[model samples]
Target: MVRVAERLDAVAAGLAEQEGPEAHAALADRTIEALRALRDEAGAADWTAAAVPAVRAHAVGALMQVCPLTRYAFARPRGYPGDAGLLDLIYRHPDADGALAEASAAGRAAYAVTSGTAPCAAVRERRRILAGAIDRAAAERPGAAVLAVACGHLREAEISAGLRDGRVGRLLATDQDRESLARVADRADAPAVATRRLSVRDFIAAKATAEAEIGRFDLVYAAGLYDYLDDRIAARLTRKLFGLLRPGGRLLVGNFLTGLREEAYMDAVMDWQLIYRTQAQIRAFAAEISEVDLAGANYWADSAACVGYLELEHA
Candidate 1:
């Protein structure tokens, strides 16, 4: 069941919707982990084979109620046709696009949160939108700060070419993955930007962060972590992020677009591949804290993935 899509094409051939949220819902935790590992590999031995890791991992961590995919899977990677389609669907939503315009009009910029460099064209598009977002805000704030989470070695470089221009301010990048962080020092232009190592896991203790970050920030931007977390966990994290913002600070969530809904059996990328979230789901989550501005994303020519960028603010 972990590989619901293993024979999905055959199964989906005759049906309008052959996927379901339940096909692999019953997988055991251990089996789910193994499946995730397999999914990650894409089995050079078997391209036809697929697996879901996030679903299985969540089966253990949150009683299967809040299963999250591995980090990499949340935002679909480039070159994967399966992922590209779903991202397309996400960014084309009419309601979603309208919300983005509203946010852009309000004059809020984005601060991208991630583990490192974005090689995907879709990610590049995501960055462009975020850069625009920050640019909008900078028009009023003089120097808008964009925060990034990247490896130590690559941290400086992410800043120099990525956000060092006069328009963008503070290319704060870091990474929690030590091994990945170590490579930062090896890159030629890596030491140009400011960097640190901070993981979403390290932020599990975010209740404490709220007291300090709230009211001080203009926005909290995270591009790829949403699909990995369940709605409940996303809610908790959103609340924490919300608290950290100044009264009007905003939070942006990034979801890869493949032109598909990505609703059920989403663990194929990890315990699953990408954990899909609807604009409705995001808006619902945002409503729990404050107002949400949802928007469909455009393509990043470099990475080749479709994306959706959302902005939710504290009223």
Candidate 2:
């Protein structure tokens, strides 16, 4: 552990001295590789509980000084990891410019590297996949109704051609955070998009009532919700969302895959934790749904193979 901390400290020092994009990129690669090696060496033996604190205390504390992205994640201003604000930074959204501007030159350089990681790439790809799914659903059934559970800012809607061109009948973008919902409601496509303040617990508790009130949807998706749910809750939610689908409608859910190279850094340094799942584990979330209720199910990984998606079609 001491050796690992010393190595990380050296990396931090190198990053501080380096200037320009190439230098930062090289140092970022070294930092990621070092964390991956540390995680491998620690194995899976309660590393989060035992190893993370030591690594953070010894080295990552200083590393975060240079990496504002890691600092924001560690700080978690919205009182939770992976908040929409942090995601904005990851997305390189203009809303994140103020936060980036607040960082020092070295910190901004580090942000560029952290925001460009393979995991971040996977997240960006996830947004693209959701947009494409919405467009496809609208194309298959013109004026399709869609539901986006835990929709953070609904950035995908910005690029969704269906929503842009008025092909989508309605898109109910729901989230626990009013701020996130407000952003979604402020979009140019606000007329076609509706915002609702709904949490997972609220949605689950009102499942029977929700269906009648929200009506059936041609497409339902929770892009980032499953990352925080356990198997039981995930399965239950899957069944509920699947129930909301209209005949021939589709439900899509995404989860980060296990064995991510950034897992250790995210866990220990950024204080971000996720319930990463295997392809089989993702499929198992649909176990409660009756075979007679479904038509087909499929799973695919993002381009970086860091995120896996499960898509189910209703009969």
Candidate 3:
């Protein structure tokens, strides 16, 4: 812990003395490398509870807060760690311009680093993967019905070829956050995308007979929800989502992997914590589901190898 604090102090000092983006980048690199080494040395133990306060109490934490990306995540203005607005910062979406403009020069410099981390890159790739999945499902079955559970802003829909080309029959995006749903509803592709205010609890409680209420989907995905669920809820939700799939349909879920290099910084600075899982652990979520109702299951990592994806095909 002392070593970690010293490293953070050094980073704070460097950032204070530096004036340009290059200097900020160097300091960010130093901070990332230092935290990664400390995290690696600590191995796979849960230290977030102890580390977050210690890190935040340090000057480096205050310095990092200047960065809009870090501040939004730490503040969690939407009452959640990984809200859609924070994601917009990661996507460098035009919507974040206001926040970026309000940030200090150091903050913008920090944004350039935090927004370009490997995990952030993985998030960007996840969006692309989601869009591609929708396109493929639409190609396989024109006017395919799709569902995005815990869909945050549904930004991927903006770039989905299926939605843009009128190939998707309907896209039902459900979230607990009305603000997030409203953002999705405001998209130009509003006709193809429908927004519903639904929580994970509602889906977990959904009965098989109630499938008609929401309708079965050709493609169902929950890219960001699994990170916050425990083993029981994750498995239950897996079964529930799989049950909502039409014949030959696909259910894709993503979770951060155990070895994420940015885990420590995310925990300490951003105050963001995720339930990182191994590929085997992710696949195990389908253990309770009978093979009779399944076509196949596949697992892969994003380009940055920070996020793992499990794709289950319904028979």
Model 1 segments beyond 4 Å from truth? 1-121, 149-162, 167-169, 179-193, 207-215, 257-272, 290-306
TM-score of each: 0.48, 0.93, 0.94
lDDT of each: 0.42, 0.85, 0.85
**Candidate 2 residue pairs in backbone clash:** none
Superposed on all Cα atoms, model 2 deviates from the true structure by an RMSD in Å of 2.1
lDDT per residue as tens, model 3, 1-315 = 435577677666766766666666666667767777766665445355455566678776676787788889989999998999998999888898999999878779878998999999888889999999999999999999999999998889888988889999999999999999888888746487888888988988977676779999999999989999999999998998999999999999999999777888888778898999999999988987889998999999887788999999999
Q: What is every candidate's alpha-carbon RMSD to the true fold? A: 15.5, 2.1, 1.8
Best by lDDT: 3
Question: What's the best-to-worst order under TM-score?
Answer: 3, 2, 1
Name the top TM-score candidate.
Answer: 3
What TM-score does candidate 1 get on C-alpha atoms?
0.48
lDDT of 3: 0.85
lDDT of 2 by residue, 1-315 (tens): 335667777776776766665565566567777877877877776465566777778654565556778888888887877889888888888888998888777677777778888999888888899999999999999999999999998889988999888899999999998988888877646477998898888767775776799889999999889999999999988998899999999999999999988888788778889999999999998999999999999999988899999999999
